[model samples]
Target: MEPLTEAQRRTLEDLYQRIDERVSPIAGTHAWWPCRKGCDHCCRHLAAPLTITRLEWTYLWEGFQALPPEAQAEIRARVAELEGTQRPYTCPFLDRESGGCRVYAHRPMACRTYGFYVSRGTGNWCHLILGLVEKHGDGDIIWGNQDAMEDTLERLSGSTLSLFEWFATEGC
Candidate 1:
């Protein structure tokens, strides 16, 4: 994979910072409040074929490097197994013991954008929004501008790699 141009890296970082600010407040509200400590329901599912930028890949590599050597080896082994299967896989960054992402700070956009409202289509499929309900119940808060944020991220980055592919190749 090619390295991200310095301009692309700056743009992506800026976009990430802006979205973090905007989403953090709304995420604090009741809609996403159920997402408390140790609730790993969202982490259990196999994620979609998320395409991240090369710069994002580099960032993820940095995070992986910070882990203890044993942890890194364990994760790389898991990733290798998953890659051999050629199917969707859970994030390698997820700590199996703690059920939390070890690289939460540098997690890709798709990881950060989950559990939020997203609208689609002109009728039944349209106006769909979802979020955490509560500590035990559904928070179901909706933010109208998430798509815009996603668009902005894509436009600014100019690079993309699938989440699984990223892990498979990052360590090679």
Candidate 2:
């Protein structure tokens, strides 16, 4: 695959920024976003449903390349377990010892917007936040529109894949 050019990188950055802006409000308003530095529950979930466009995956790969050789080997080694029929597995990029993304700065849109919805679609919001919002009768709960996100991503990279699959198969 061709290295991402400067313009493409900037585009991806802009997209990430948009997602960050969307997440910021929900994170700030909801005291239930217990996603602290060491909280890796979402990343460590079995049957994790991480999804991202090729553009996002490419960015992730870029981050992967920058890690030390030992870290890269460890990431590659985790692929086999992730590919197995096991019910639950941690994300390969997750640093198990620290419970953080090895590629935090370049994490994909899905990772950026996981706890909160980018749109008005409900159901997937954090349970605590959802109940609080409901009890307080504050406003509608809008989750990010994954379909709409795919539409925009398809235009950029023309492909999407599960995050685990990407790690397992190296985005083949």
Candidate 3:
């Protein structure tokens, strides 16, 4: 994939910022939400099959390039281990010491979807994870599901590269 042009990068950043602003209130109001600073459970447990556009992939590749040599090697090793595993692995971009994403500014859509509400569509009931909701408390809010967003991103990007595949193929 080609590198993102400055304009493309700006656009992608704008899109992400908008999404973050729109989704934050919903996520912030959830009850049982243990998503406090230093809590890394979601990053540790969730499988992030990235559905990034080529431009987004380029941005992530840039992030990989910015890391120190040792950190880059570690990330590559982790990616190699996760390449074909059926189970999801922890994100290589997660900073274990900080309990936060090292590539926060360039994180994929899936990373931004946690701690929000997901509608069931059939009137079945909108669901928020109990643990999250209990911690954050329900405030008036609406948001899309992580699964739906992932599907939509995949469709829009016309790409099937999983997170690990993207990392490996992009020379990250």
Candidate 4:
């Protein structure tokens, strides 16, 4: 609940850098890559409320504060409406009209690593990506290990909580 310490901030930033390095080369090189700005399929098809580490929530809050009052209000309303939502609910941070994340840059590692990472030797991505991989083959794609990334995040940040829980606790 406290502001991130200097060391924590640096470590999180380093993680971000590593993610960028891993994602950069493969971002647009392959036709099978379905992740892009305005492509919100992942956002729309979340299996559960997005869970994030304390460090990630701290950073995401910074981006939330920078938004206009109206935008923040809209997001707040959306979060409030999600209390009883079913599985595969849309992300509250998604800007429905634009089909983009409202806090893309500050989103948690889960969002950052979504389609680009593989878990348990399998791709952790959407149906679109699966279809593409089936047709074009996944040989050219550069995949980051989701399990490793998750371990790094846990080591850097400690405890984790769902986005809804964070909103409830922070009263933001």
Best by TM-score: 4
Query: What tens digits encode model 3's per-residue C-alpha lDDT throughout 128-163?
Result: 356445566446556556556555556545556666
Residue 150 miss distance in model 4 (angstroms)? 0.5
Error of 3 at 111 (Å): 0.4
lDDT of 1: 0.62
Error of 2 at 160 (Å): 2.3
Lowest summed lDDT across 10 adjacent residues in model 2 is found at: 117-126
Clashing pairs in 2: 46-88, 117-143, 117-144, 118-144, 119-142, 120-142, 121-143
Candidate 3 structure lDDT: 0.65
Superior candidate under TM-score, 2 versus 3: 2
| Stretches of model 2 off by over 4 angstroms after superposition | 46-49, 118-122, 125-143, 163-172
Full candidate order by lDDT, most accurate first: 4, 2, 3, 1
Weakest lDDT window of 10 consecutive positions for candidate 4: 27-36
* Residue 10 in model 4: lDDT: 88
Give model 2's TM-score versus the native structure: 0.80
Model 2 residue 3 CA deviation (Å) reads 0.9
Give the whole-model CA lDDT for all candidates, comma-separated: 0.62, 0.72, 0.65, 0.85
Give the per-residue lDDT of model 2 (tens digit) for 37-67. Answer: 7877778874554667777888888888899
Instruction: Name the better of 1 and 3 by TM-score.
Output: 3
The predicted structure with the larger TM-score, 3 or 4, is 4
lDDT string for model 4 (30-136, tens) is: 85567777788889989999999899999898888888999999999988899898988899889999998888888888888777778996656668877888888
Q: Which candidate is the best by lDDT?
A: 4
Q: Estimate candidate 4's alpha-carbon lDDT, on a 0 to 1 scale.
A: 0.85
